[model samples]
Target: MNGPNDWFQQNQDRYRREQYERQQAYLRQPQRPTGPPVRQRRAGRRGPSPLVVFVFSAVGLLVGEAVNWFKDVGPVFSSVCTVVAGLIPLLLDYWKSVAEEPAPGRGRAGAPSYDRGGTAAGRVLGVLVFIVVAGAAAYGISWGVGYVTGNETVRAERLVSPVAGRADSMTITVEGVGVTDHYTKVRISAVSRAPTAVDVGVGHDCQLVDDGGQTLQPSTVANDQTLLVPANGVTVRAVITFTGRPAPTATTLTLDFSWFLAHDFGFGAHSLQVHEIKLKADPA
Candidate 1:
């Protein structure tokens, strides 16, 4: 029979061989990755390109100008219009993207990639468009809110109309009568039927006489320009400003155009005047 030590040694060798084989088999098998699962990065939203920005800016400018052309409407209207236009590209892009269906067979666990405007060029173009649209929109909103509204530049209602008179061969139509913080303004259009242009002197004896016997002297005549009525049925517009505000309680006012008529050297009366210009019931 073999010795006990020899038998023990043989058993140990077999055990070691079995352990090595098991380790080799484990190494050959596919590995289950350790730590967190590697995730596919999502495509980011790109900004608008320079070309798109330029186009958008140009469009905004054109729209803004168009809106500004209406004199009755102020910059507020123009700015609002421009801003609204600027948002068009973005809105279209958003709607178009939203309207599209997701790529067929794509799932949440997959690459998660999809068409970005359909191609690489499209992506770039989309970026450009977005930039332009966004920039224009920002400018319009800022200008309207920051500059226009902050300044409170809305024009006040001032002009009163439908008052007229005639002296000699010159017909004077009062276009408007308006009051300001400092003075009252009277706008008139004078037409001369004479053969030559009539040189009307406006300063001397020109005044506004209120019902309360308050008289305000003429401060300036048509921004200090000479009042000349063109001949042969042509009309000349002039603005006459008086020094003081009329009395609030005064219901009726008179405008004396004596000096203007007298200096014309025509066939009309020198004392031409509008006896009564009815004031508004409520005064500001």
Candidate 2:
């Protein structure tokens, strides 16, 4: 009779043979398609393309220019409007991005990966648009601030100049101030005992001094070739102006000038002290 070990070995060999036969039978049978055809996942659509964003921004810029022309808007106003217009589209795109749905072929897990702009191109274009708008807005704000400040300073109350210095045979009087296309023009009168008409060189430019010890600059650019040639007379009157854009506005501005009676005569540099005359611009 066979012992326990002999019997165990025989049983194990029979089991192995059965398993191999079963596996071969399975392999020979027609195999069904694996795991129900991988469910085809669709990729959803993307957001606005980069080209679209770029085009929209360009159009916005053109529209802004047109509006400025039609409305005669200031530079600051035009720039501000353009910035606002350009940003509207960008804002919309951002909102869409924040609410983007899952794309086809991409699962719910991919939703979080949705970019602000649908496509890479779109995102890049959107960024460029934002940059342009931001720059324009900043520029507008700066320009507006400067303009308002400058106007206020030039429109303040005026202060009269100190009494004309006592000098030899010279009388400098502050006639008045008037508004011209260029600026608040200053008028001054001077009577000098000179033989011929004096060459009164207004000297390139002038400045307005206020009683509060504030110095005023001209509102307009200084005319490098500006000169005032007084008529031949004992009493000479001339029109002059100063740079006021940078100067403070006041009810009265002290007109300070070196009264050059007769630069043509032998008087040479021998002259009186600087003449200060208070000036007030005519009512607007």
Candidate 3:
């Protein structure tokens, strides 16, 4: 029997009270995180923790250095270390193998959307840092190998005169001496007063004599064919190579036997002499 206006007023007050109670209950509940994992805003994919990425990269670099230190000791052990270093990047995605349940009813609808803004930027930065550190570590390790082994090569080049030696009546002249990484090459010309051109012998019998008389021969050596003495003596050119550098002062050359014997015996073991000429020291 109440008027319609009175009933409407009572109903409005009841609705307001109910809404206030519901809000109060919601506030009482504990706060919870609903956002994606840190550093990853890939809407559907989980990203690696930044801290973990940094630690993994640092460990990788250290492992790489260790590998270089022990590489010469055991190839097998070094191989293992290299493998470990190369696996660092794989750690970032270690958890990726576990399949993620897609949003219900969202599967097959389309590719999940990603927050490409800040999330993508952070991931890019992380990868860049990893690469830079890795490259620096590799370069440092290579340098360390050279330092630890003490096998650096020597390089030098200079014009030199005939040091010394002779093959009976034959004459040999040194035109240039070049010393490069791990080897030395000597250019020379040879001629014999004989009426016909004679062979220019080379091989085991040929050696380099320093001022100290250290007779060292190349583990291997070769000549451009052979030097011949034409009637006019065309001053044929020849080359000699050795595995290492000679003393600052190399003073003699020795090639043995008649030039003709060279034709009969390939790289024969014989001795001859080409005495010193305008030999001079490398400029200080």
Candidate 4:
């Protein structure tokens, strides 16, 4: 029943009240964002870079080689140091990569879960690389040492023939002495008339006599033909007989000794020889 002016005034008042109530409500309530909170990319822990690791490894190798060049130390030691130094940083990088990677089942929906960290396969490969590098370095060092040392030598002597007889039995003798960086086995031989021929019997109507002057058996003759000598100074002897009717013309006997050095250090072998001669004639 109000006039136009009155109705207008009432409408204005209602509108103002509603606006005031809305303002009051807004002031009383906590401020809230209209949308979801923005997620920020997290910064990862800073670590040494792969490039840095590689550079350090190279430096280590160079340092190791330098040490070997300047010092008389064995190649093995220097190479080991190089390998260990080079591998440490690599191993650390591998471990760090593994630590920074997200574990399984941690990715968002529909997103592929990546094990950014090293896998078991990668770790195994790294270890194998380290071992290979180490082994190669060690071998290089050993070779260097051997090259520098050169081949070693030892001296030895042996008496080739100590006994001589014609239709007579006599004992031959051998002797020797020497030094070596390794163990060696020695053999000595005695021959009649010719240093190259082993003779156990005579046929010219002459016969070797034992103390009883009896002809010696071929086995007995050959049995006394060889001797084994040791590395150090040693004296060895063998007895043999000659048989011939013409009193077995005077005969010459010869002895020869030889040896070979044996060792495990990759050093080459060494050897020596010695000889002796004697004459035998019919026993007056």
Candidate 5:
């Protein structure tokens, strides 16, 4: 009963209405964001906190300074201080082991609680101990190597001995010369030709002079100080120590006994004298 044209117009009206309805429904719905997707940061293992590191470093520095201050006291004292410092953290860790009690109807009472703070502190202390031990071991090895090397070098070179020189009525004979990287030791015997006992003092007046004119003072004296030389030729042995190895060019050593003679022996400046000894591979 309907014509073809009418049928086509009805189909077109239905299609338009459906499209309008779909657009309206879409418009009523919430709008979706069109920006880039957000990303979440992944969790990872963390290192020691700044405060913990800072505290550990501060403690280490304090301990190091304390050890250095004890060096002048003696090596034994310094070593003891270092050992005690290393043990302090371990002792504190032991004390930090605290027992916690649970509530009356809860889990086992008097059980030990996990202390995160204490664990962290223990780890830091362990790291500090390792560093200290490694440093000490390295220092000892270096010292040993230096000592061995110094001895080898010293033994290869020849030095003059039995060299004698006189100042005023006192005569000094060089008995030995021992050289090393850490120190240089000279042994000498002194005797006086004076009719009476002569008082002689060894101090700054004693020095070692190199061929380059560089002079080094005695760091220590063994069995050597102010001495009384008997009237006869009775010899007194004195060992003089100078810190560190002397220059290879040290072919001569000059000793000034003027001050000691003037102060102790009542010798005038005009009567005072300086003694020079030649150091060589062969006797002169």
Candidate 6:
């Protein structure tokens, strides 16, 4: 048997020989000729530049604004004009590209050039056009709806009787204008000191009397009657009566309207009563 050192020496020598032989074979192979390095072409054909798309879109928006300002054109018309103007240039560019390209089944161009039609730039333009048109339509619809459903015209008036020794009366009238198919209801209330009292009566019977011998009738009150006022212009009235004992005092009356209709109005009789009277001794 060989000793351990002799066996190790022999194996090392065999491995070195195998490595040298592989290196020699690699070196003997023919060297590849290095010609001028081919440069990589940049992606995308030299079609209509992005700058063109941007310019066209900007021009379209400007034209739309001009039309809107000069002709008072509504959003629909403005948006239509904008889309048409913007697309016109893009369409022309697409057609030009199509015309320049070789017919189908022809030999491929260098490195499979991309078709300019429906390119990234064109898609971006299409999105912009769609947004403009949709936005304008929505704005116009909202404006029309608001104009139709808004509040109608309303007019209100208050009538107060002259001050008396212990009683006071007041009337309130509310009218509607441009209110179609609606009715009106009016409510009146009286309050006073010096033992004042209220008497609810028909449209013509409402009155106010004081202990100082002063009196007021319905004729003295304004908006005390109800009539079928037209929807175009109609008015409703309320009448209240107040009577009381003698005292040097002033009274305050309040009038309110509720549940008003155009053709037939309804509201409950309302009144406010107080027993304390504050009198203005002298009129300025």
Clashes of 2: 29
Q: What TM-score goes with each of the models? A: 0.43, 0.33, 0.37, 0.28, 0.40, 0.27
lDDT by residue for model 6 (8-70), tens: 999999999999999999999986545533334335645456566556655665665555544
| Candidate 5 residue runs with Cα over 4 Å from true position | 1-158, 220-225, 260-276, 280-284
Per-residue lDDT for 103-144 in model 1, tens only? 555444433344434565875686566555655554555455
Identify the superior model by TM-score, candidate 1 or candidate 2.
1
**Would you list the C-alpha lDDT of every candidate in the order shown?**
0.61, 0.51, 0.52, 0.41, 0.54, 0.40
Residues 1-284 of candidate 2: C-alpha lDDT, one tens digit per residue:
99999999999999999999999999999765544234332354344555665566556556655554344344555455556655666678667655653456555432323333246686678667776765575456534533542211123323355345334545566655544322454556776555654544454434666555666544443332333334344665654545442233344445554445455564653334344444444344
Q: lDDT of candidate 5? A: 0.54
**Deviating ranges (above 4 Å) for candidate 3:** 1-154, 158-169, 195-197, 221-232, 248-271, 277-284
Task: State the local distance difference test value for candidate 2.
Answer: 0.51
Q: Which candidate would rank higher by lDDT, 3 or 6?
A: 3
> For residues 1-284, could you state the per-residue lDDT of candidate 3 as single tens digits?
99999999999999999999999999999756554333334553455555665466556555654654434232233333443554464443643523343445664433443333345477667656655555555555544543344222224455554454455445677776666444556767776555554665455546665556655554442333344545334566666665556566654444332333333333433346555433346543
Query: For model 3, what is the alpha-carbon lDDT of residue 280?
Result: 48
lDDT of 1 at 240: 75
Off by over 4 Å in 2: 1-166, 179-182, 217-232, 245-252, 259-264, 270-284
lDDT of 1: 0.61
Clashing pairs in 5: none
- lDDT (10s digit) by residue, model 4, range 1-284: 78999999999999999999999999999765554343333355333565775566556666655665445344555556666766777668657766755665564544433344445697678668866876586656555543433211222322223433221112223222111222111222332222122222112212222222333221232233433322223333433222222113423222222222222312222222222232234333
- Model 3 clash count equals 14
How do all the candidates rank in terms of TM-score, highest first? 1, 5, 3, 2, 4, 6
